[model samples]
Target: MPIDLSLLDDDQRIAATAPRGPVCILAGAGTGKTRTITYRIAHLIDQGAVSPNKVLAVTFTQRAAGEMRDRLRAMGAVGVQACTFHAAAMRQLRYFWPQVAGDLPWRLLDNKFPLVARAARAAGLSTGKDMVRDLLGEIEWAKSSVIGADEYPQRVAEQRRTPPADADKVAAAYRLYEESKSSPDGMLLDFDDLLLHIAGALENAPAVAEEFRAQYHSFVVDEYQDVTPLQQRVLEGWLGQRDDLTVVGDANQTIYSFTGATPDYLLNFSRTYEHATVVKLQRDYRSTPQITELANTVIGKAVGRAAGTRLHLEGMRPAGPAPTYHSYDDEPTEAREVAAAIRGLIADGVPAREIAVLYRINAQSAALESALADAGIVYQVRGGEGFFHRPEIKEAIAALVRAARRDDLPEDPVAVARAAFAPLGLTRNVPEGAQARERWQTLSALVDLISDIVAGKEAASLVDVLRSLRQRAEAKQAPAVDGVTLASLHAAKGLEWDAVFLVGLVENTLPISYAVKAGTEEIEEERRLFYVGVTRAREHLHLSWALARQEGGRKSRSRSRFLDGIAPDLEVESSPQRLKRARTCRVCGTPLETPADKALARHQSCEPDYNEDAYLALKAWRLETAREAQRPAFMVFSDASLMAITEAMPATPAELLDVPGVGPMKVEAFGPGVLETLAPFRSG
Candidate 1:
């Protein structure tokens, strides 16, 4: 369906329909930046201002590019090239490889770490994998910043940047790396080379560059604030003096500076393109008023010109409960409490899939993962291997691909899938462990997806479907499963959840000890990270910190300064002692075991919290439904299940099923009455 321009807000309409020359959108967190970019592409196509094939949209990641393509395709503007900077450059380089750098027979080195390690060894460096990785990172930073071998030391000294331990060894390794790449025997280029080579070609080879400029006459750059010097060089090369470009970014979210990305490109876009149309998008639709306020508060305290001006978010959603702040005894206790909170929410009817637990670093996930497992609440880690990459799942995928190649199998892909996996013993010889069970669930999901795709298509063949499936499998794509998400703050960018727990908000954790020592700029980046985590919540936001480490022998820590920046009015603060016993009944002085207990414990005639009334109503309905069905009340609805229902207050049967324990069986049995009990609260 064609997008109706009238549906957009005033700012969005201006962003989407701006005169098509140089444009810059200062989009804040959750301001529908993606929507604006997609709409701008659609608007241009709809207005016949640019052909679909003539436009190019560049994103930071392949996943983001895929999302952009899906959005543009949905808006009926197909054929626009949406891809990463590296991908676009690689395509152009490959097409012009025969013309520019002849017969070198170069191949892109996807993993540069091994090469760096090799060069380090050649340089006689006695370093561990971690140290080598750091050196490789410095190398990447140097390359992206356009720093060459001769200028490496001068650049580091000029910027007051601390060189890696074994600085001399690292420099030697860098020299070796450059030599190896320039040698005839090692005709390999790193990811940075993809942009550098293409930009070099454009700068030196005008004919080849002009051909591309003419081919992609218009452009859109997403996340422009993270563009490095090399990326900007390529963008400039492609733009060549044309003003048909749109850049969308948030300067406050410039968190990738370690990799040489600077906010200068976005901050100076107006100065560069003298007549650039700048639009500020402040309407945050992804977070509650409380969350938006907290984010604004964090960013407001940021120092330096890069902080830009803090844009106060005009929240699009209604007022939600005040954001919760919790202080825990230790990391384990924190993880356990977070897990319990997640469980309570799910039982109250919030879908497990709608909740997320975010942390400052990857190490924090281990304790949380263990706690969630002990609680029997399923969860998927964002950057971990995940269920799709499990050994059993990988084996099943390989078997299916082998089966797909057989000429004797049925032409329909679904039939081929059945024939392939049934004999693989995925269902018959189920594993006994939790990880194995998760893998089994992953396999079942893949089979269902294939069946659904082939069900209505008469012409679908095994080969074509297998090809698509294989591509997705290779991409490490995991099908959606019912589970809470655990992700690092960096990984949680561009994603939001209904309930978000920002865990490990201690002094050294959020700003990190390293950032504290690095000076002002690094501390500012840490605040930006906190700002990012704060904005990734829609309705509920819970911020937590551990007083001590879970591992023995650590001193007690203070709360992060970033947390101190948040206004007290915007959060409901509690210490470990308070959160543990805070729910005791006011009149009876009894510690309520559950939301249901608290509801029933309240003085009958006295005024109570609205949630208590809703919980009482849900419990009554669940008991009656269980009695009528001749089932145990627990089977009809577990306390956790009932709690989730009460809290979520789902209005429809489908929404009711989103609560973790309300699977198809429960939904079929008790959904109508559940909806009835929730209808009044849902309206409120």
Candidate 2:
């Protein structure tokens, strides 16, 4: 059936009118931006003005690419080249090599860590596995950013003067790595090199560039804000002076700067093309009005970042539940409360698969996961290996090493790891024993040793060595049952769930302490990450934080600053349910009859100064929580619960449960005590 696009408003109609040149859609959240852009592609094909192969669509993630392709296919498009900047580059490089770069034979390092570790050992880096792994990340980040040996000092930004492996040595190893790739039987082309080679293909050989230009004369990019410098450069090289670019993105959503992406590409697209069609979408299709209003309030504070990004939820259902802010007294309590919320949401109709519990660091999810289990909410982590232990890694590593040798390792190891280990377990080694521990420890040491070697230099027999390691690891593999996914926010990219619970919304995590604004480019990239997290939600979205943890530990944290970036109309907050600051009458120990409080407003003139204990209680709770435990409480239960109870005066345990947030568990726990403490019913 044809889509009732007539229902689409004017801006959408403009977006649908197959753009002739550069079309920039500065769409806000829920504005049907993706739908409009997808329809535009379908329409172009429908009009027979563009062949499927002639149109190239670029997205930031494989999932996004898949989604675009699926949408186009549904609308009758076939054979469109829809893929990530990296994927597209690789696809083109696969065939254009002989024509452009003289048939250079370079093997790709699909999983560079192991190979790098082997190389590190060959280069002689004596370190623990954890340290080696960290080092590999640094080296990979350097490579990804195109920071060469000569630019090491200027680019690394780390404090070490003499690197663990000296600059000379590291550079020497990188040269070896390059040589390994350039060699006939060598293997190792990192994703960074994909862009490099494509750039070379376009810049070095005019024929290759001309062929691509002739074949793909028009382009469409989704989530354009997340495009990297290399990607942008490649697109420019391919498109040359032609303008047939339709770019859609929201600048206010810029949150992925940590990965070297930028929203400026989308923000300044209009300026980049003089004859561009620019459109702004304010009709959000995701969140409810209550949610939108809170989201709007949060982002409204953003002072002049993006000109046209507006998150309007006026068109969605009036509201669902106002985003509740739950400030806990402690960490465990917070986790427990969050679990309960997940349970309640599930009971209220959210499927187990619909909910996601996200946090800043990988560590935070442990407690939340435990709490969710305790609550019996069937959950699967979005990231992290739930089962597969060292043995599992070795098997995958062995297979991967073998595949790389055969040029058969798929594009993503993470994907392969996921598929292979769906049946593995973490306790594959054995029950506790000194010998068992030693063998595991030795495997750990080897993994560490290999990582150190890989992060340093190139090595030989990498395939054979990994195969042996795999055999050793396989001897102790275990199979796992079902569980929620556990992942870092970075790993959670290009994914969505029915309900997303952003656990560590604290200041340092979502914006991430390491996320820095080195320049205008970096700052814009950071904003794009915020957009990524927000747009990932297909339905329910929960942002949580703790006021404190276990008594005397790290202080509980605040909500993610990204939450502050949302447009107020999005209503990202259910704050009355999360936070409360109520004045009380000293004479009667009753809440103040303030103008905002309907029931108490009549007695406003006679209200007395509230007891200071309430505020003290809040402060005391925040100070006494275990940072971890406190985090969950603040995530689920709000100060409003206590205040609402204190003011409403539920005289009995049953009546107590009648309060919106009160449940049977609370009645069995605090009901008797709270009911006994309500002095007298002093009517307002």
Candidate 3:
């Protein structure tokens, strides 16, 4: 059966078509973009606008691709081409490699470290294993920006403070990378090679390009703002001269600029397409009006940013509460207050899964999780308990030290290693072995020079040597971060949660321990960090920090600056003094009351045995649950929510989240079990 486009509104109708020329759908989060793009592909197949084999749909995530496929079937269409950018590129490169490049190699490398290392060796530079990584990054960034080796200096000169050996360095490495991968020998493809190969195929083989252009005829890209030049070239090849293209993305959500993605692609949509249809999905269904306002305010005024060409959000939802503003004396206090709110919410019937805690860094989760437990909010931390155990961060750390000792450390490796060290209490002063000594030296050198490298530019002083190194060592692949929920700000992109809590908004944490001078690039990234944090919240949002915690009985701490801006009319309070039992009158044997109902209730007997541990535990739990919300936990509840659980004692699934701390998803995941467990005590 043919799919229906008539029922959709104007924006949706344009979104449904197997269009004639280029189309851009500038959608915000929760704007039915996936629906529109999926339906468009289904419509194309049903209308016989393009052959199924020729059609292509590139989404950011694999999960998105799967959902698009399911939606096509539901709409009575099947097997329209759809996949992630990586998956799509791999298919085309594999199919036409022989015709395009003559001979087939086993595979291409994504990391391209080997190529960088080889180039460094050829250049007569003395370096270590990790330099390969930097060279690859430099090449990838250059390639993404569509800057050829000849024109690299003028275009990126301002951007680079500590320049490498001009365009020749990257060009040389790129040539070596090409030789190693496409030399009819190896079978390994790193991430970027997939795109480069397909682009290579299109550029070299005119016939293959024509076939793809004629067959696919139409196109759609999700997160269009994130498209690199390589991706844009591939997209152009797919559509050819035809404007049968539709792109959906928000420049505001352009948080991936560091990865060589540019929102300029989205900004210049009109220039690329003969006729561009621009629409916005600004009517966000995910956040409340309060959250949306904050998002608009923060992003709308972002300075030194390119002006948005044409952007608007329609059909906004009704207003909600003013986002609660709070600032505590330190990380612990902030975490505790956030937990209290979660507890309060659970007590009011919200579920644990419905709340999320956000933060600026991965390292901040330690204090947050600790506080949640103290508050009895059993949250599942993102990626899990053994993050420092990650092979890559540690290896990179160790590798950086080896390289740094040899003067070959890269920024990413050093950053990874340094963050991992704070918790381990590891210091460079005590070098354990050759490996340790090498890593320690690298870290030691970096630490000494970091204050001056306030901007990431100065940090590039060690680039050439490091770039030559990581590229050479292919085995230095860092381990993947693992946890039930994510704990790092870097890993939280393109992801969302039912509830969000952002902890450690202080100047040093969110803005970070790195980046001392706080230049434009670093600050903008920080803003984007906050922007990402804000968008992750679907229903509820929280921001917090700690007052104090005893780590070896040292009580020195500072609160996050982000908390200071919003927490209006700050009130710092302490635990009220406990009543004295010895003040009873002799005639009535009553405790004298100075205030409320004191005279009437004074005759009641005094209770004994204060549960300090229980009270402190509850207090601690409140702070913990409010730092970040990145994962689903076992039993599907947060610790602060559990305190709410203990307090409310609901007897049924229907009554579970009604107890104040529960979230919608948590209720679905563990509502019944939690209810059953607590039902026995309801009668008591």
Off by over 4 Å in 1: 1-3, 385-480, 551-555, 565-684
**Model 1 residue 375 CA deviation in Å:** 0.9
Question: What's the CA RMSD for each of the models?
Answer: 21.0, 18.8, 20.9
Question: Which regions of candidate 3 fall more than 4 Å away from where they truly are?
Answer: 1-10, 17-19, 46-48, 110-136, 147-156, 161-189, 309-321, 336-349, 373-388, 392-484, 512-518, 546-684
Report the lDDT of model 1 for residue 567. Answer: 29
- Compare candidates 2 and 3 on TM-score and give the better one: 3
Q: Tell me how far the alpha carbon of residue 316 in candidate 3 is from the true structure, in angstroms, after superposition.
A: 4.8
Ranking by TM-score: 1, 3, 2
TM-score leader: 1
Residue 270 local lDDT, model 1? 93
lDDT score for candidate 1 against the true structure: 0.77
Better model by TM-score: candidate 1 vs candidate 2: 1
lDDT of 1 by residue, 201-254 (tens): 888898888888889989999999899999999998998888899999988998
TM-score of each: 0.69, 0.63, 0.64
| lDDT, candidate 3, 1-684, per-residue tens | 767667555677766773545678877765667777777777777777776666677888887788887887688666577799889888878887778756646564545555667776775542354344455666667767776656766666656522334455656655665556543354566777677778877877788898777667667788888888788888776665667777888776676665678788788888866467666556676677777766665555555554444243332556655565555654445665777777777777767656666665444554455445556665654533322333434554464445455432224433433433433333423432223333343344333223223233434533433443333222222234321243566567767766677776655556654432437766666766777777776656666554333212122344544444445544532312212244553236656665432422233354312322332343344344333344333234554456556665566654553554354455665566565555445554
**TM-score of candidate 2 relative to the true fold:** 0.63
